[model samples]
Target chain A: MPLRLACQAMGTRFELVLAGQSEDQLRAVGELALEEIQIAHGRWNAFANDSVLSHLARCAGGPPVTLDPETFDLLQTCVRVAKQSRGFFNPLLGPLLHKLGLRDETKLDPAEDLGTLLDVRGLVLDPKGHSAQLTRPGMQLDLGAIAKGAALDLAARVLVDEGVTCALLHGGTSTALALDPPPGKDAWQVVIGPEKHAPRAHLAHSALSVSAANSRRGSLPRGDHSHILDPHRSRGTRHLQAAAVVAPSAATADAWSTALVAGCLPSDPPQGLGLLTQTTSDSWLLAPGRPSCFHIEPCTTTTPPLTAAPF
Target chain B: MHDNHSSPDRRTVLMAGAGGAATQILPDFLAARPHLGADLRVGLVGVGRQGRAILAELGKFDEVTLVAYCDTDERRLGSAARRAKGAKGYATQDAMLAAHPNLDALLIATPTHLHRAPCEGGLAAAKHIYCESPLAHSIEDCRAITAAAASAGKVFQTGYQGRANPVYKLARSFVRSGAIRDVLSMSAQSNQKNSWRTPASDPVRDKALNWRLDPEVTLGLAGELGAQQFDVLHWFTSKYPVRVEASGGILAWHDGREVADTVQARLTYKDGSQLSWNATLGNTYNGTQEILMGTMGTVRLAWSHGWLFKESDAPTQGWEVYANRQQFHNDEGITLIADATKLASQGKLKKGVGLPHPGLYYGLETFFQSITQEKDVVCSAEEGLRATAIAIKVQTALTTGQAQDISEADLASK
Candidate 1:
């Protein structure tokens, strides 16, 4: 029997299933993976006062904050994705999100321009020193777009490094990664969403992430709007219904999926990643790049309930 | 018509403000941000879990620059060096110390039995030393390290973090001021559920990684896990236990390991006041915390959070009106917080329920403060020696299932 473990992190549930001979060993390794996720959650959560994001915010006008290799790498990836997605995957939307009622209200002055706080270039990374600094005051990093997937990727790495051959890891049910196929199965099947015609992704040594505008609605009283905002327009997208992507990296898949759904991708996504997007209410299109893993099974029966939620 | 009768008077408000200032908890660098100072070059002898944690906290201080790292494990050494940025890695403590001769301080986080060598090396290099506790696996080793530190004319701080924690410091002040009246008894526990084993690639490496399971050189759960808590109680009350009776067994992870996974020890102080300590690797109920019950009240201290529960008959202070309270069953615990005056003024007292950083951060901060500001050492080497002695006796009691009497000579460093 495959050992299963779960922990709540990043405002969602992270679960892992591992196949191994020793149950105790599997459980121990899985626990370490879960511990990694929890640590990442504590460190990356932008709202928490003790989180590293808060530390960075506190040091906005002071010296640069030295970061560990893991954190430095994560931030570097965030910046790269922000550039690649043409600012769609911005981590510096913290103050703007707060103004949009996405985060807890702070005592920020009403006259302060929220747009000035959204500049990704204001986050300076000193690669040689493995440190980072916010050049502008009041600039903060939200990291909501990719933190969960980055945590899952780290957890998956831990499981792989521990000599685990077959495992499945997911963060908030929206992003899933697989190490290898389970016994007597070709790949681990993950449904994209909770719909009869939802596409199924057969993941083997890869990851899949789904983003939907209807997943998380804005909390503001100004009618319904997606929480996944477009930095270019500073408003949530309404055209695309949902976007799902499969890639070798979970963080990359998570980032690009959000970008695609938010209409931030100028053209096609970076090569080698598969993309399946819903352009209209009933119109579904599977864009280029390795769409072999995803199947639109209309006659499928017995829903496994391993569907990804809007994240 | 409103009830102005319940409003606080001018004298009461002024006294309340004075009471917050008198605690002197707001000045620490953790609550108020730290200021820039001359850089202090530092090196670490071990790149294990604790060492990595220390390095992370050290990075928070702009004045502290990580110079080098030393570890025998190639994987850990490389990983730690990569994360440190601009720091070199060495295969031995001697190599790192010799290469970084200008280093202002050295932190040691090697295994319990392996601390003496690195400590002696750092001391010989004339570097301020911060060694993790329980100082060493043997009493003789602890004495040797302490004696070396005594003559080194350098700051030698033991990593017993309770002395440096801000919340713990605030609570200690309450105890010292007789706020809790006469102390009657104390209890502390560290409960966590894990195998206490690290996964290694091979058997040879596995033996080295699983040092906690080696009975010959390893102090059982009582010594390794309870030493810090024992030190907390000693620091708070300014007293040490003279006798310890303990019992233990391997309740979980019975994989041919002789070290106990669970232990319970009862320590008798000179005043007949006792400390009950329980530690286990099989359960994580209530996590880790210390409780001191006095004649009038009780102070419960977790690592990052602390609380003081006062008796109804206990005289309430003016600051009690401003304190943040959390209910625990039928009892109420007043949150023990640093920067109470500042937070209360901002009307953010509820946000001060716990520390903004882990206890380890304050301990490392204290080490740097001692190095740069010439501040007094928080946990001195001699104090660490005494705490280790108590822990060793408790471990012996656990092993023999008998009461072990602690002699003053056992705690002497000379």
Candidate 2:
């Protein structure tokens, strides 16, 4: 039998043996999900256009974000993650990230050699709706840093509640979320890597992945571009070919691992992540002393670089 | 050695060729597909009557291999021994065992009374078995056979051939799929009025011929025809019959027979599914020619003139019908679903539309296949116990005036 949706208080996407009332309920849930995505997308793009946050010394006017309730909820989550990462994973990077070609507004034209120096403290959030005024314009707010992972964790929770016990949700394949316990099998597993879209890559273990070749890279349908703009170089994150992050969720692993490489953390692995990056010799090297905050482990399995499906 | 990670396989003899003739059915069965992946091979016990016919029938399959053949009658054993190919023939079953040490399955078709011994022998040899039903001489004997199979980890599939009829399979499929909604109850008839056999002259032939009348050996009337009918009914309704009410008496026979000429039974299952059936082998004209009824549909899987009834008006003054054996096979005949479809094709598509043809031989096939795979067969010892328990009660019902309650533990010693 195929996986059936477990309709519960969380949501409704039940797969029935006999097509009964369940068909209509799932369609409604799908609609709600799409609307949520549009709202989140609009909010992120609005932050990119606001000029106040970046020009802190030059201007005093900025735009306020106006999106639906879900988007509002998403921004609130950003405030939470920013607080958790201690501003190190700042969502208020609108000014500095934009200057480095990271904002969704401008068609990014990358300059060579971007590296860390992006200031995290310059960003701020207003507790009220549509009212957080950036000190000046050109301050691009990029929630791209952690919102994708945060949303995945949230959506997985909701989807599981809605009777979707087993699913592979790709919020853009670079970030994937799998929420299934390995019932009648070895263990719950997933695959993460660049070129994950290639037929060759398959999950045999629990995994998560991210790469610099996202859509920001070039003219490919879905290539991982260096979305992480090194504030020092005023350009996209560079060098160290592709990074393969294996954690429980692609959203968190992919986003944070990208942050790690873009910030120019030392060649020796940091304590908080399971980092595997391609070396000049083409072999992948891993980081040391993992962070106790999340579950991540050294992986020996092969994976292709992640690419987007033909939209 | 005690440390374990996998589920324990509690096996029962599923299908072991009793002697050599099982070879007849397999070659034709496996001939079309030379491989069963890794299924068990079958052996036949007796090469007389049913065993002889089965030997030739199995000859049509390539998947069948002759293992060993047994017969108390040395004359028949020698002839069958020559025809059985590489399989060895023994005057007694013990000699055959000394030869095929690796033998995995046995099919017992000697006689209704002789079914238990070979079953016990096969069990001791660690072989899965598919035995002809009634299963044994007494409700007690059948119980003993079932217990031995359970203890030896051998699968036992009682030969209840009519359960293999695709119409019953079709009806079960429909009901399980909930096409008919919660079933209120069900009723079945097996009025197979006499004319089942011919008269015999020789005393020994007469003894075999009048198996129904012989109190000395024959399981009597209920065992002869009632056994097949009850087993099929038990399988069609997943519930073992909780009680049976029956009345039968001997009205006529060619020679003042002790066996009843007419017998009928009414069975009530746990869910209150009522089943009524009659077997009067003396009369042939009254035959409905293979009929089945269900909540969602009704079907006839007879060899000729089959019919399927779906949510509709009552069957006509005469039954709705399809001609030809094509009703049993599909356009390709490669699988069972297509074969059932050819019968069910006329009706609207419903859930569980196709019947489960675990097969008359397919069950036997599964028996041996499980032995080969070292897995247990589908039919459990308890199922054999359940069917036998109902049969004894039905026999008692035919004679005595009350209903009997048989529990799982009651069947254990039985």
Candidate 3:
């Protein structure tokens, strides 16, 4: 049986289940994983004054600020996804989010045009120098959707490096990554959504990320807006109740799920991706090279419970 | 590869000799102290730069009382005493110990040459001792102090603050847990553009303050700066060095100083694990850090931050998805074990500003706790002696231009 350990990190609960390791070894790996998550949280947190993202935001429209290789690569991925999804995965939406009163502090003027500020195209990256600069004055980077995924990826890396072959790592139950399975097991069995309404999927060496409109409670008094803002619409999008994507990486899955939920991409995603989206009419699964399947299920819950099979 | 010849019995005898005086005084000391309460009265020896820093940290603890400040320099003592307010000032360590009979502990931050006297004296007085690193300037003093501390039966902690650092603690845990697999070798470097000289109005006092430049009173870069790094290697490997080969010269700051501003040394353990270290005072290119290599992975650690780099044949670490795509040329490791700047940004500020230098607060806190709770210190006298012996041997190798074998007999001789 796998030993499960849970701890709070990245503003959410993270769980790690490991098999084929002693209790002491499991605890050590768990602690290291949690610490890595915490480190990622500190580095990428947009609201933190001393975070790398905040520093980049502050240095916008100025000289390029040097970043560590890990952060530089993460930003490079963000830029790639933003271009691929036609500005849907824009990290430079901090001003728009702040203007909508979603973020803690408003560093931008409400009267200012957010279209110019949300332009991810203006962000310049020096690959050789390992530095980045935002060409626009009001542009700010927010890695909210991707940082947790990156942190999950880091946790998985730490576990695997520690000689753990079979492990299930998750960030706030929304993004889950499965390492290699146990000695005799084919894959880690994972159930998506609620018990009666969810579909069971076997995962191995892959990650799954879920983004739902109701995942974050609306902070507005009228309950009209969500935490996930649409960069193109310059507002919150709730057209889809939920969207889930399975990819080789949690970071990729996380960004794609957010893009799908924002209605920026079609229901049919790119190749090598398994997608599931829930709408008012019906729930659909869009697997690569497979026909879309429809089902009737209630998807009103903010957070769908996830279940992992025994190791 | 060096052979393992050191026996446990020799170590026991060395420890026994070190603790002899303290054990004899323990009963009377316990009898004399009727009530051991929350408060711990501590005397400060060598209230200079590092001493004052420790004093400020000690002031933060409510359970600590800075009862006395001792320094050969009256001016520094007076300045430290002013900050301490109610604490008494003494011109000499002997006077301070003589006056402060009720002091529960002595914090020795004296010069390298001066550590042995105060440390030995404090143990003789039945007071728990916390001495700054390197143990002493010379091997003889290191042996004498180690034996005295072992004999004392009181808590005797060496000032290797990395022992109390959280990052070091996590890294050590990772190594001890066998996560890094079989150890191969280690490399460490410390680069700085520092003269290591303090200004003084009096010529004699200038020489005294600038003890680091004088070979007679200094351990050079290997002992003075490399002691903590060497101690960390030993801590992670749980083994002492069997041989040390060193070479150095006064490559910079040629102001009549006899000590080398640049030095390099290689230490070999009985287990065949080797550690290579180098430090240069002329350049600040890659400011101080250590890297431990293992069969499975590599751990790169500085004072405030650390990262884990897995080997190519090791199991796939998932972070590589993010790390491998980065634009930078350097390797992006999997786990960021400790990053003080990031932690502080997240509002986890309990550990103080995580600079490259080892924070004195945690070490001092551990010292106070050991005193009141009767617990063992994180860095014990024996551990300090081991590191010191290796450091001294490195210096000897540099002087003789040959590799020196460090045997258990060397430790047990004194």
Candidate 4:
């Protein structure tokens, strides 16, 4: 069991573990976790300003924020994964994620206009110097929410590479990834379902991720309200209990699961699957019925105030 | 690599755990395990005719200690566990591993395709992984296993013990010592009606009863017999097979097996040395021979039998065939023409002949020795991966009517 910041290796989340030679191994792994997180999360560190990617990314177009490799790699992954997933997932929602109390509490105050101009296409991918060229001037990419997943994948990879074969990476139960199946267990036993008074352990093979109204709220979605905004409505969907997604890779699972929770998607999931999803009314969908390894628990936490994620 | 190698730790686990993880790993895998000996501690996975016979042979080991027994068959697990020294039996891999944490090493007799997990899991626990043959379901699985072994720095050698035998070792030493001059093309083949079968009979029905015949299990007979044959090639040449082309069909068992009852393959190396072989489970000669053709002479070795032929310059050589493989002399009785092995320190050999021998069992001993010395096992992790790659290449060719080119890149990717 290892824990480290999964700084966008797969998606957004700091991977934390219970097993390693020490907490230092986990920390050391997190320091070098994701290629993107190195810049994206680096902003929260002592070398924040010196790292051109995150610092310049925050204030692009106004001034020619020089291109750095970190931001370059991040934008590249977003475009590639977005293309592969057919637009169901887009990192352009960073501002929207921030508004939902995800990235930073202070920046939750958008600059006058937010979603209307939010376009991932507006972010130009540059090659030579290797960095993003924000065509829309004010446009910024906030991969905080989803980057944790990419981070989980990276951290999981580190544990595997380091020699701790049986382990799980958990980011306070919100974002997580696993490396190799548990020693003798079929998969990491987890709970990703509706709340039963007490939490019970359930075993699963696929990477499991859960996002729900229990996290936070942005604006008010038509009638629903939660931290996750309806980008179009700039609000949350108080209509869902929790949306869970599983994928062979953590990034896909994290990204898709959030999309589903945000009510931005229908049931068209990915290949190699098993879905047991429930909406606000409690009516649910168990795609192809229950998976071989499935577990659910009622984990409803008051949304954490949005802040720069401590990667 | 032999499934029934003796180990004290292997025996004690049987007292508490019957058949542990092996049963649960693959519920339908089957192989006939022969009666090893007596009071044997034999926990096995894959209950095919070969696997079952292995269990019986495992019974031959002292104490009949079968710590854990796993099979795709739930019925087999229960009965085998109850029958074998009250061993703990499990139907799932987790239960088995959990039940017997001290499992010395596993006797992985699963079919050619389903051999990955047990071998990997066994090695993870630092156990003496005594797998049967062809230690992976696919090249990908084998590579993953090899990587895992390297990461863990564990002792690993597959169940290809033919070249490990003493007779083949001597043959290798002699041929390499220049007794067999500049080795050219070598042709080793098994020809019989059953060796090269007719065609498939009933594909659908066999799938339900037996999976060994299943393309998934046999991995094609090429993986089974051809796998061992390819290992012999590696032993003599110290080079990965440059390419292999194979084709076959089931003649008799076509009605019941997914895999071809008969199989044939040609392994071509960069140096122009080629080896071809055929095997069918019927009256297919049941005879095995390895011919080392060199510029100086030709050495033909039959199973347990040996012989040599020489060119004009080789007057010291006698042309005679040996009746028994063990005797010091042949029918012509001229010392069976011993080669000048005493002249050099190994690594100078050009050609060598090896067949499936108990001597291959020595590779297992070497594994334990390496473990004790904290050095690498004789058949290194990379060696196991290479052997498995060649095995997969042959299987791929048999599956697709065309030869699948396996580049080092492809092997590394797997």
DockQ of each: 0.41, 0.00, 0.01, 0.00
Off by over 4 Å in 1: A20-28, A100-105, A193-198, A212-242, A260-268, A277-292, A299-311, B1-27, B31-33, B346-351
lDDT of 4 by residue, A66-181 (tens): 33333455557677655554554566665665555555433533454774446666666766434356555445565534655655555465455445555566544665565554
How do all models score by TM-score? 0.89, 0.44, 0.51, 0.43
DockQ of 1: 0.41
- Which candidate, 1 or 4, would have the higher TM-score against the true structure? 1
Interface RMSD of every candidate? 2.5, 36.6, 22.8, 33.1
| DockQ leader | 1
Measured on C-alpha atoms, candidate 1 has an lDDT of 0.80
Model 4 global lDDT (CA atoms, 0 to 1):
0.51
Question: On residues B1-414, what C-alpha lDDT tens digit does candidate 2 reach at each position?
Answer: 011123211011111211212322322221222245563466789876567545544542355677788887665687576456667888777778877767767888787777788889999998878887767767667777878977886666667655444444434453454434444454444454333332343478647644555767665556765666566555644556666788777764444556567777777767767767666745544353333455655444432123444555432212122212233343211111223222233221121122221234445555555655645444555555555666777777766667666565655544
Fnat per predicted structure, each in turn? 0.33, 0.00, 0.00, 0.00
TM-score of chain A of each: 0.91, 0.58, 0.90, 0.66
What DockQ would you assign to candidate 2? 0.00
- Second chain of candidate 2: TM-score? 0.72
Of candidate 1 chain B, the 10-residue stretch with the lowest lDDT total is: B1-10
True contacts kept of 1: 0.33
Per-residue accuracy of model 3 over B1-414 as CA lDDT, tens digit each: 112223212122123322223332221111111233488899999987678667645533556778988888876876675556578999887888788898999999988888998998999999999899978887788888988987988988898877877667656666665657888999999997556765454579867887887767777888888988888887877777899999988887666677888899988889887899999988877688889889998887877666667767876533243221112166656433333223323333222223222256667766776888765688887778778877888888987899999998665526
- Per-model C-alpha lDDT, please? 0.80, 0.48, 0.71, 0.51
**lDDT of candidate 1 over B1-414, digit per residue (tens):** 001123223233223444344443443533425643568898988898788778777778777878999999987887786667788999998888777789988999999999999998899889999999899999999999999999999999999999988888778877877778899999999998777877777888778878998888898787678999999988888888999999979997786779999999999988899999999988888989999999899999998889999999998666686667899999999887676666555545555666767778878888878887887889898999988889999999989988998878888888
In model 2, the Cα lDDT at residue A195 comes to: 31
